[model samples]
Target chain A: MKLHNPITLLLSLTALLLSQQSIAAPVEYIFINLWDEYVQQTPLPDPHPDIERRFLHPDINIDKPSVDQFTALFPVYDGLKIDTHNQLAIRYGVRQTPYRLVVEGKKVITREALIKAPLAAHADQPAQDQTLQTLSGHPFDPTRPGAGFRVLFFSDSLCPFQHIPNCERRIAQNNHLSANIDYPVITVIKPFYVDHTQVSAYQQRFNVNHEIVFDSHNQLFRRFEVTDLPYWVVQNRQGKVIYRANQVPPLPL
Target chain B: METIMKTNLKTFLTGIVLLALSATASAKPYPPLQARTLADQPISSSGKITYLKFWATWCAYCVEEMPLLQQAFENSQESYQVIAVNVGFNQTVKGVKTYLNRYGYRFPTVFDASGSITRQYRVTGTPQHILLDASGKEIYRSALLTDELRQHLATLTGDKL
Candidate 1:
């Protein structure tokens, strides 16, 4: 006549909550500002008015290279990881001052785009699979349709700032994933500074023993809309994109 | 009575004119790009379909793709304008000119000394191609000479190449 055992029900509820948390990855807003020292401290034009109104508080200042300032401004957000060396800015390829982005679980959204549309509209967009020639001289399709979780790692061999801690850690994580049999990882090199011939050396240099594909013509970048380096996207067996972030996300349990 | 009717008609016409002006003003034009070329010539889109190629002197891919851009420039002569913008990343004006002269590539070049124009377009990498239609709306953007870019150019200018 009892509905359930109290101890068993409590454990079941905890497991249910943990499962939900993993499924719903945390959404973070990463704001990268060009340091004043990098460029002459000239009076810059005001950012887009909507940027001020929607994304930032009026009192929070930007364009200064100070960890204290960022920490003070973004005290509440867990995703506000400070990069004192401006490595994140370089990784995101920030050419302008005060670049802002919304990392909603897997999707990277721009400030203006996010303002115009709801996050749901930008969610679960499928990553496009292109036929690329792998280092082994075979046409490789990254989107292993109906396979287990496929890890697409976007790395740049010639990235000047690849030595940075965050970048190095991401590379190490990929290397570890490369050896793992559960995740079929493919390192997609940026075509800007990398050619197919250099792919082998990149592998040897970084000890990236996994499948390396040179994204020729940048079709994959355009299709996936990824502009940053050391990025990762994980797609499930059904080819449904579950997660994508600048840094590697944890593998689903 | 005739005078009164004429006054009302004049007021209605003014209202319509103001409405039309507001509509056009609200239709945002593309970001403005006005700069002097390395050869000291002023260049702007000037209501023409303009192609912007963001490149740096040190970028190897940019060096390799210059010839294709030169051909595109020569082919889309009257129908479109091509402006090669030096991204101004640790590059000097003299170095850019020397490189251009060495190659004998004569497309209009803008040395974005302060990276103002480059920042405006948010160009992250070199050899980035951006094509705008005559109306100044960006029609295409790519990192390489893709067939899609060629198709966009062909459709816009009726140029087979």
Candidate 2:
């Protein structure tokens, strides 16, 4: 069978793996990670209502700016010393991911990482779908089903990795701890791609008595701002936000 | 004479104990499900020894292990029957059949769509191996199958794995 561009898929999975391994520094278009897939949950119709514009007038693509030319992108740093997208590119040394220069009437404000293509602007107020049910699939209002220590699982019981004994043998080998007390596990599921049935079988068999919620339409994916499997957000039941675990070393038990 | 009878009875009980221990030393063989032929139907064998390997097209590790399994099958086809069970979650029947063809796999295959069988066997993952004797009794079940297992099969089939 003809395999679709193997290089691209490798690059993508590699990018995801790298993002999880690196330290917490704002990556340029770092959506290659787990929640990156969840970001896709938003259809063409529903976008992020919150006008969290990372850049202004990101449409104007200057010819691949030279390293020094990138200096013009981010004219400001730290305290907003007239942020320029050019200088920001130079600081970050970005030649691959398309970045934009944010300027306000010649006075540069800040350089922000630009999207590859124009993002569909839905920067409105956060209007969560009132249709979300609880983990039990019942109408969950007043009490936040999401307002607690969330445990994100990335298991397809169908996958042989399930037998890797992560749950069974509990190997003390190299572990990838997705959640921490500092960052509770805000569990997410893989999208319904080719192996969705695997996930369905897994959920039906594995989640014997555990609580779970599905992003069937990827709606919840947009809200919590997730895009990957096994990705989690650790928060408190008190509605206090904790550190979101991008990826951490697994705890050896 | 009464004392003599009691001593005789104790000796008989001791002999029975030794026999039971010897039987416990060896685990009995089991009979498992048969594999389907290239035509997608169950293929049976008389006094048959079967190795049912569960695998998928997407798994990298599973793919890596295939050539070794193929080698093992080639090593012993006459004495034992090797059945490859395709545990696929996605893809058309054509896609699966095409893959098997490309692999040049000659062993009979069985397709499980809903993965109900995978669940029934408590199989968490692959490459899983389930061995059966002639009567379809399950003998050995393991997730990490190795050459040692092949050697074990050789003993059951009275051939080399």
Using TM-score, give the best candidate's number. 1
Give per-model CA RMSD: 22.0, 29.3
- lDDT string, candidate 1, B42-156, tens digits: 9998588899998875554466567778888888858889999998754679978987897789999999876667667756555688987667777777765555677777776
Model 1 per-residue lDDT tens digits across residues A92-150? 44333333554433455543211111111011133344567778776766455345888
Worst 10 residues of 2 chain B by lDDT: B26-35
Query: Against the true structure, whose DockQ is highest?
Result: 2
For candidate 2 chain A, which ten residues in a row score worst on lDDT? Answer: A28-37
Go through the candidates in order and give the clash count of each. Answer: 1, 36
State each model's CA lDDT, in order. 0.63, 0.45
TM-score for each candidate, following the candidate numbering: 0.40, 0.35
Docking class of 2: incorrect
**Per-residue alpha-carbon lDDT of candidate 2 for residues A164-213, written as tens digits (9 for 90 to 100):** 33432211110223322343332234333213444445455443334344
Looking at model 2, residue A225 earns an lDDT score of 48
Q: In terms of lDDT, which candidate is strongest?
A: 1
Residue-level lDDT tens digits of model 2 in B27-67: 44332454455466877543676677877654433554566
